[model samples]
Target chain A: MTMSHAIEVHGVSKRYGDGPLVLDGIDFYARSGEFVSFVGPSGCGKSTLFNIVTGLLAPSSGRVLVNGVETTGSPSRSIGYVLQKDLLMPWRTIMRNVILGLEVHRVGRAEARRRASALFDAYHLTGHEDAYPGQLSGGMRQRAALMRTMVTDPDIILMDEAYKALDYPLKIQLESELMDTVKAAGKTVVFVTHDIEEAVTLSDRVYVLKAHPGQLVQEIEIDLGTDSHAINERRLASAFNDYYETIWRSIGAGGRTEVAA
Target chain B: MTAFQIEDAQTGAVRTRPARSRNRHPASRRRTLLVFLQVAIVVAFLAVWQWGATGGWISTFLFSSPEQIISVLAQNITTGELWTDMGVTAQEVLIGFAVGAVGGSALGLLLWYSRFVADLSAPFITAIGSIPVLAVAPMMIIWFGTGLVSKVVIVGFSCVIVSLTNAYRGAQRVDPDLLDLMRSFGSSKTQAFTKAIVPGAMSWVVAGLKLNVGFAIIGAVVGEFISSSAGVGHMIVTGSSSFAMNQVLAGVVVVMAMVLAFGLLIDLLERALFRWER
Candidate 1:
């Protein structure tokens, strides 16, 4: 097994023109085939950090290395980013939307269609290839978004609350599917979500974060002894609540939960 | 009939679900009645007007009864005068609409590439757009002469501003998320413009086309009114100068028909283009 990191963020800090640092000295890394998540509240600069990792926004201080080379000021195709919203082009059919990256990369039309068709079948979106995004359910749209990202075959995947918009049942189902797909591909994933249970269930390691100039609080390695690919089963593991409570406390939402209880 | 079968969430038993009733074909027999009522209103209106004119209850010379206008239309059609005028006017309106709407949208969307150019031209575009087409019509005629060129220029002028502004606004309002997605893919600026920005602004561009349909017709007719020997506008002007109400109303009827035809054409286009939206 390769122990080298696939992505590394070295003391990254971001500030907007004399404002307080949006991200304060964030040191993060993801090893090959590892699933890492940043669990935090809103305004925690998770999105800012994701953008920096994607090279869309440059950090004020420090650098990002992708595949061991510095990638600064220029976005590379080595990373695939799936955002909170599906961002599917409404004018395009599901099939067309999935092939957008290939199209931008100047892939041949026939080849792009062929590659995209395989994803539709594997993702169980076979019959919906021709349907527009508007006609699909929220879960299906999110699935298509994931398919769009995965088809590009980026070594590192960055998801920013990608499944937060789905209902509980769909979220769990997609999480399982995502886990299986990433495992089979052996791709490193960096996920950001405010859902503690989600972070606990899906991630191999979780980074707890606090708001207001977003800083990392703790890093917890999850070892539930359950199949991570089976996210629902992982939720039922004995270590689930302990990990959730620990991350929840780090986020400082423990008081509210206690009051509610 | 059963459309499909599914397991009930609570019972875990398979249940056949009936197909949804679209109600596309209503059993209520009101379609014919509605058509008859609409026809009745129009016929009643014409009958009352004709009766009033014949009985001297209204001034036939001023109002030009429907029968008199029909007679004038028939005469003009037989002489081929009305056909020539309509053809000229339609040609101008259509050509102007094609050129102006397309050209303006292209220029507006192209502005997306350079924020500096867009910001620079904002006030100038507003100033030019605010200037009434009537004020510019004479200047256009003086420069280009009272030929088809001037009329075409006038129609195009009336259309260009609205289309430019609408298309530009639409491009501006495109969801930033999509642009971010494009950037994440490392798409070139031109690719982003063509694949994302242009398609994003299409609905607004189409709306501009619809609005410009009216402006095009108005411009053509008004150009004819200013200085033209042939066109619906000329027919209306000649009839008015001679106090021939029938000819004037005939010209009006022709223009109304033109507007309706263009409106229907645009509606058909909109339907075909936006099929994916729903």
Candidate 2:
């Protein structure tokens, strides 16, 4: 783990009420400005870990520190969380929904609109300012969710399966735009997804989790060619196959973790 | 409509036959047929009624032939009695609906925010809501007298109960995820209530009003029936006493028309207010 990381999830574990443990002792960190992903099959506790890190749920054990300061089970402006569901308010217009965070923070409505207006065009949501979430297509709805997250300009962003609902081309386009935006702003991003290729393409370091009482299985550091920015181009690079194969084999081994790889 | 068809990209085989091939002319044709049948049914029913009266197969004194009812309607229209009675009933209903809507929604919000108050009042509210308004109409007349006060009170009472119930249910049904989102943003309880809860309850409020309008009209007529001089209920009661079947049927027809007009107004308001719902 990098020193003075933007997030520190030290030995986190979770079990709801008297239910079986959903996660075992798991620890990870995302350094400042680094893009990290947590990936595994269903029931691997990826979302459970995310909820703890974002302070939405308190871990049964251990604590999370944002920029080295603990904020467990409390709302914090330091983190922005985008859930798998878009969670858009159906009643509000797109502009109003996107500015919800600013409104919650007590920012003036006019000022919030000003800040949000600049992003509409860049996010490909220019003409939909007055439209409701139901009016937008599925991909556009997810993009609006992203815009809602990014507009707050939080110190750390934790996205839980943010693009899984979308189809291929739109997902790829959104992934690139989000990457470019976060990279330019130098914000720490922790993404959770089941798609290994998505993790490999977007993360600087990808941490794989084991299913049922989730634990950290492996951490792979991704190394893209020096100048590659386009995600699809990176996917086509010769080096890409090696990384995919390695991760795939590791996951297969992870299926029977007791056996030697 | 777009489902179950798979032209496999690699093998290029039609794996599953599209069920019923829904995108054909038959669907539109069927709708046209259904509409024509509806019009035909209404016309046939009206013709049968007119034939029964003119052919003397049914007693006009008891059934009040369509022509007699229509003549009564024309007489009332010419004398301006229909408008006067409608105005009186409409005034009572309007005052009642306004009072009930505002008061019930406010009380509901209070109950929503205060857990103890909600728990404390739960049994009493259910008990009160279960009682029929018509049974209490006599008591209302005795207390408020034969003027508009009694009618308005009954209408308002009916409105309050409905609005309160609907608003409360609406608040309870707010999406839990949205609540979490608000909490994650560090929104104050008040902010969450105003921004999320209120808007979420709007559909429920509209639903409550949908019921309230009909109930309020019923309450108004009942109140007027007990002791009012200038309303639809008075006309119906007065016609019944004199055994004027035509007059009674005319009053019933006028009431039906007025209720339909109010219902249309509600529909328009619902469409305008909840335009985003669709």
Candidate 3:
């Protein structure tokens, strides 16, 4: 419980009843303020691992420690999760959707409104306060979801392919915004992605997972140290290809039986 | 859809061709024609009905003439009886609908929240729902007396199952992803219920409400038929007793208009509240 890591998983294993392990002996950690990524081919249990970390699903075996406290099988407000879909309540305005977490915690209505409202300008969502989620574009919807997740100021944020749905340009834009914001706020983030280039571009460290008894096979440190604030600029860096190549090769070398999503 | 338009076969291609007379502006002429047809049919039916009733082909006692019914309606309006009967029926319907909504939704939520209770009560609800509502009307009158109380009870009885079924389905059908997101925020069961489950099921609840509107009117009217001093149903019963065909038809027309009004009101309210949907 007193570990120095911001989050840790030890010997985590998962399986649906009587089924073969989807995740086996999965061990990883993110230090405080670290940006970590999990990369694998389709069906590599990357999402399963993220779901377990978010406490949305049980691990079947092993434990998850968030900020040195075991949070296995119990959801905690300290960690925020953003699923692939925006999951915005269609009935609520964008502002209200962003305030849902705070509202659930019984923060007074005005206070929650103020906190949520503050993000509108910062997140490029100004003047969209009264708009419903359905009215927004896909990229904007995801941004609102990010605003919702980050508004609560959770210590750890788990993203399960949060940007894959957007077009390339918006995906890069959002990816950049997300990293810069999380880095500036000093929050630990664990992102799961199918695209190795994205994994390398966004994270300080990328964990390569193998399918068919999904397990961590390699952990690569991305030391591009690029000065560009934009993800497109990061991708253009001379070192970007080397990092992408490395992660792709690592994933390609893993188990070929199971696919990733 | 714009990628492929229907072919103008004689012209061999649609995109290069100017619009045809029939297909011009897509729905332009079709729209006007449809509306015209609808109005023409209504007028034609009324003309035939009026002709038949006035011409003595159909007995006046059996099927009242349109003119006679209109005069009867005019008489009721001038005498204040139309408003009184309408007001009485509207009050019963509104009150019954309110009570039924509350009770039905509460029980439905209970069923959704508790597996044990839902399993136990499923068969009972089905059994009660199958019972013809009119059969219970007399018993309800005997128990609660010929007043608003009995009508409300019958309305609630008629409506609870419809609400319960829709609401319970709504709760059960919530997106698991939404539930997960709520839980990740440390929301308790009650919080999830209020914040996620209920909103997820609001559409279903609205559907049940629409169904309840018809049931509520039926229960109220039937209760009145069993015994009541003033209501649309009471007027119809009295008109029938005295063999006043015009009055009876007028009472039926009023009831029909009332039900249509209620339906339209609900539709408007739903549209306003869920404008975000469209």
Candidate 4:
């Protein structure tokens, strides 16, 4: 059973004002309910690609389609984004933060409140509805941020290095739980990160992007036998190590050229 | 698992002892007590001043006792002169404050929305703000005559510049990430300004307004002193010219009370407006 494409980007390019191109002629696609990760070194324009796909930035060339609708320069309502920072309003309680998107979209206040309440248990943020974002631990803040994104019920979610700041043990724990939650919710996700292990551990397929004027270099599919949580498998580690070495070699050559400039 | 059990046991013991209050050390309590003691010392000093004046250690001609000032206040109150003068001063102060605040906020928003306007007026605003209100009040009275309008303008002139500068800086200093988030969410330019910029600038705007309260009162009083036939400043001027030290002291006391009351009101407004700042 094949899933339909939820988002499609074709020959997209981006350049800042009077500057060199940051993203050059990239192509990517994600199917419904698929978890895809884009991994590359810093300044590889992974975030730029995420921004372009989410309609935050207008691509210099080419087109993007979300749910078969053109989204090149058009704002998308079906997409939800989680930035690197939690960006939670310090004045708002956890419950209020989660319902912010819905309120902005003009969803009925009562209905938005009800939907947010239902997500509390699933997001592991129960008994924290009254707590302000400042009172939360880093991990808990990220969890609340995730719940905020999910409460809008967007068909596709774009996360830009959302877990980059967490400690290693906490990162692994949250990644597993996030995978479980994503699977249960049955939403398509495009996660951008620079970590090779994180890319292989959570993604159904990983797209490796090249540095400086980022372009799609390779796409590797992971067949982890129906259980994404078994990311600690020995075979998987070896395969990820090989992929990491290849990526590191590519980045090394890219870095030398940058230094020569 | 053993480490977890041990940590849990420690936490349990800590929670059992009303740890929240226990965590507040003696040093913090001493610091709080010290602050109260300092306030008491100030009150005691004021009481000594009253006692020294009444006991004739200080001459009544130079320094009227607190009791003399209180009696004068009571006499003026019974004769209805206090209320009349207070009403006049209150009107000038309030009108000036309102005009200054509204005009300043509007001009500030205009400048914030237009970079070219801000660039054009920055130096001009600085020059005008540099001039003291005392120097301006007499000139304003000469131009507008000894009337309420002159006093209100004097107060407004003193206050508007501070409010404009603070509000403009506040509007300019919004977090870039918050703006980006709003952009990503498809907020229109107007919506973004309304939701993010206005709310973000409110605290600084309130700070500027609070500072301007004292300036407004001073402007009104100075304007009255320069030319007015009425108001608290006129009473002070008359008392000073006649060498009636008690009346002068009484007028000074009334002005001080007005300034303190306005300051308290501003503090209340700050609390009410920026409860989130807590």
Measured by DockQ, the strongest candidate is 3
lDDT of 3 by residue, B109-164 (tens): 75767888888888998898899989888999999998889888887888888888
For model 3, residues A157-245, the per-residue Cα lDDT tens digits are 99998988888889888888888889899999999888788887888999999888888989998888785658887888888889887
Of the pair 2 and 3, which is ahead by lDDT?
A: 3
- The lowest-lDDT stretch of 10 consecutive residues in candidate 1 chain B is B20-29
How well is each residue in A1-261 modelled by candidate 4, as lDDT tens digits? 644489999999999998988999999999999999998777789888988998878999989999888888766888988877998877678988888778777789899989999989987899999888888899999999888888888899999999888887777777877888788889899999887677767888888777778877778886545464644652265466665566556556555223110
Error of 1 at A225 (Å): 1.1
Ranking by DockQ: 3, 1, 2, 4
For model 1, the superposed segments whose C-alpha errors exceed 4 Å read: A1-4, A253-261, B1-39
Q: What is the lDDT for B172 in model 2?
A: 83
RMSD of each: 6.7, 7.1, 4.5, 6.9
Error in Å for residue B149 of model 2: 3.2
Q: Runs in model 4 with CA error above 4 Å?
A: A1-4, A230-240, A253-261, B1-37, B40-65, B106-112, B138-146
True contacts kept of each: 0.80, 0.68, 0.86, 0.25
- lDDT comparing candidate 2 with the true structure: 0.84
DockQ for each of the predicted structures, in order?
0.65, 0.54, 0.70, 0.31
Number of clashing pairs per prediction, in order: 0, 0, 7, 0
Chain B, model 4, TM-score against the native? Answer: 0.84
Local lDDT at B51 for model 4: 86
Q: Candidate 4: lDDT of B219?
A: 85
Better of 1 and 4 by TM-score: 1
